[model samples]
Each structure stands twice: as C-alpha cells, then as structure tokens.
Target: MSQTDSYDDTYTESQVIMTTVKIIAPFTLTYGMFMSLHGADTPGGSFQGGAIIGVTVLMLAFAFGIEPTRQWLKNSFVVGLVTGGVTIFIATGLATMALGGSFLEYDAFSETFGIAHYWGMEAIEVGGVALIVAGVVITLFFATAAGFTPERNRREDEPLEGVSDDD
Candidate 1:
C-alpha cells in the first residue's frame, strides 16, 4: 500500500479532537495520581485512583485503535500490572500478619520498620491501586472489543424446548 493508503488504514483521529485530548489527558492522569496519592490524607483512595487511571487508558484506546494499542500493551504487561498490584496490597496486610498484627495495619508496618504510616498507606494507594486500575481497565477495554464469540455456543443460544423462534 502507498503512503495515502497507510493513512487511511490507521485509526487516526481528527486534529481538533486529538489536540484536545492531548491537552486534557495529562491533567486527567495527574488527577488520577493525585487521587491515589491523596487517598490516605484526604477523601480519595486506591480504588478510585485505579479507576481513573483505567479510564485514562480507555480514552487512549478511544483515541487510537485496539490493535495498535495492543501492540504496545502486551498480555504479560497486563498480567504483571494486575498481579503486581494485588501483591502490593496483599503483601502489606500479609506483612502485618507476619509481624503478628492484624491485616493492613499500617501503624504496625510503621512501628516495625520505623517508617511513617502515611508512607505505607501511600504504597497501598499507589502501588496496589495504580497497577490494578491500569491492568483491569486496559484488559477489559481490549477484551470487550476483541470480538470473541459468546461462551453459550449455538446449542445454548437455540430456543428452549417449548419456545418458538417467532415467540
């Protein structure tokens, strides 16, 4: 294919929209980070931060195409992100357990390790959340658009014994 054909093939966005998202995306991402960071100190927290980050990736997917995005975001990365996030969150609780404390006792971690409670909470917020949000969001966004066949199959999709197609 020629250069013109290549341009046609790409899932290119309009200039105006592209520029607008470009301008807005950074702030959106920053806000997401802020959500995670501020969760312990303020109203926001891990889950919300994760969702925002996920939405940011979804927006990028909207801006580009699934295939191209998939090219950059491999399965390993997605799995790693999710698994790593879970590990971070769980490990915090586990560490406390190991230290003979209750689950997710940030104060325990602080007292044991001579670290601040806020820092531990931030770890839970940023590490646990950011990865989980990014992984799940990106995975779901791509999976939903992957065009896979339903699990029900032809037999399951067929009408019930008493039901008619017309009915």
Candidate 2:
C-alpha cells in the first residue's frame, strides 16, 4: 500500500463535542483576552492568556477535526501573528533605547513622551508576548498532529530506492 493509503484521514463527527466547543470557545477566547489585557495588574500574564487562546484553537480542532481546522486557519495568518508580535516586542525595546534609555525601559516612554509606563508594559503583554505564544502553540499543535511524511513530493507509483513492497 502507498503511504497515503496507509494513513487514516477520516473523521467521525461527535455532536456532543461540537456543541460543547461552540458553547465554550467564545468564553474561553474572552477570558484569554482578559488575561492578556489585565495581566499587568492581575495574576495572569501574556503567556497565560496566549496559552488560553491557543488552547481554544486546540479545542476547536478536537471538535471539528484537525484537517478542517487547519484549512480554516491558514499558515500565513499564524506566521503573521508571530512576526507581528516579534516586531512589536523588538520595536518597543528599540524605542526605549532610541529615547536614551536601556532596552525595554518603560520609564523612557514616560519620561520622554509623557506616556505611562503601564501602557508600555501592556503593549508588550498584549501585542508581543500574547501573539507569540498563541501562534507558537497553534503551530506546534498542527505540526504534531500532522505527523511526519517522507517522500511527500514523490508520486505514489515512485518507489524509494532499495525498498521493496515485498518487505
């Protein structure tokens, strides 16, 4: 049998799982945002919030099938999330340096631009750490679920040298 034929791609739908995910996804997402936004003041931080957000996607995948969820969430979107987060994080640090302060020195914004240090911290939490964590988690989940496939580019009829179907 070919590699593609050896893999089971079928999904058995479950009404209970689907219904539960539908009910829970929104609240989970909202809580994640709240954690990220309020992290500066509250117990939760960007990592926690981002992890929550990533788990929401995982919940969806479990309910709706991994392939469907992967199709719905394009790779570009994930890449953009990670890229934007890193850029925001780096820019925030660089901005502090540009203002004659050390990297990631929130006081610089407060001193030079009259911006509150709290806002700077919030930006790092919400725009930087949160996005990076969410994107990374999702990427890891998808990669693990997909598993590894060798000779992906080769045709089904093409055989790997020295390997025989008789084996």
Candidate 3:
C-alpha cells in the first residue's frame, strides 16, 4: 500500500489540550501585549511580543485543529494586520520628515508638538512591528499546515500526470 493510502487526515480532538490552551491562552496574550507596549522601557520588544502572540494562535490550532483556527481568523484579518502595521511605520517616518526632521526622528514630535518621543517609539513598537510580525507568523503557519498541491483543481484521489503509483 502507498503511504497516502495508510495516512489519515482526520483531526482527533484532545480534551486535555483544549482545556490547557483555554486556561493559558489569555495569560499568554496579555503578556504579549504587555511586552510590546512596555518594551521601550524594558527588555522585551515588538518582535518577541509578536512571536508570543503568534504562538498563542498556534497553540489554539493545536488544541482545536488547524482548519477551525483558520476559519476563525479569516484571510482579510491577517492581511489587514500586516497592511496596517506597514502604514503605521511609514506614517510615523513621514510625519517626522514633514516636520523637517530625518526619517523616524521621534524627537520631531517632541519638538513640534511638545509630545514625548517615548510615545512615538511605543507606537512603532506596538502598532508597526508587533502587528506585522504576528500577522506574518500566523500566515506562514497556516500556509505550511495547508501543504502544497501542484494542481489546484485536481481531485485528491487523482495522481499527478508524471508520477506513477509504482514510483
């Protein structure tokens, strides 16, 4: 028998995994947000926070199954997250330039509006880097789980044109 014949694609739900993830997901998400928001003054930053947030989704997938998780998060939301992040980062840099400062010059905000430069950095870390990283990580994970099929319209039982069952 071929490997495909023996391999089962069904998802088996595990009560323990579901329960554990349900209990821990909230704390992990909160911690991720905290790391992103407070990273300017602390050790963790947007990348770390974003990864953690992404992992939380993975954990959910493991507990509930990839198909369900993918259904819950929709394609538009992930794309929007990435797009919004890029917009925030670009807008911040452009705002600085418009104020007669170099790109990403947080000091421009301080000088122009008497606002703290810390807020600018926080915005970049929280809104730009964090969202971009999280969205990308989730997207990649989902794509990987889906696997690759050479022909989109091909049926599951149909073999590729060049490949033989004996091979």
Highest TM-score: which candidate? 3
Choose 2 or 3, whichever is better by TM-score.
3
> TM-score, each model?
0.74, 0.87, 0.88
Better candidate number, 1 or 3, judged by lDDT: 3
Q: How many steric clashes does model 1 contain? A: 1
Best candidate, lDDT-wise? Answer: 2
RMSD of each: 7.9, 3.3, 3.6
Could you tell me how far off, in angstroms, the CA of residue 160 lies in candidate 2 after the best superposition? Answer: 2.7
Error of 2 at 58 (Å): 0.9
lDDT of 2 by residue, 20-45 (tens): 99999999999999998886898989
Q: Where is model 2 more than 4 Å wrong at Cα?
A: 1-9, 152-167
Q: Whose lDDT is higher: candidate 2's or candidate 3's?
A: 2
Best of the two (1, 2) by TM-score: 2
Model 1 scores what on Cα lDDT? 0.78
lDDT of each: 0.78, 0.92, 0.91
lDDT of 3 by residue, 104-138 (tens): 99999999999999888888999999999999999
- Compose the digit string of candidate 1's lDDT tens values, residues 1-167: 43235233457667776677788889988888888777777786767887888788777667766687788777898899999999999998888888767898878877788887777678788898878987898888887877554343447657645457787
What local lDDT score does residue 87 receive in model 3, on the 0 to 100 scale? 97
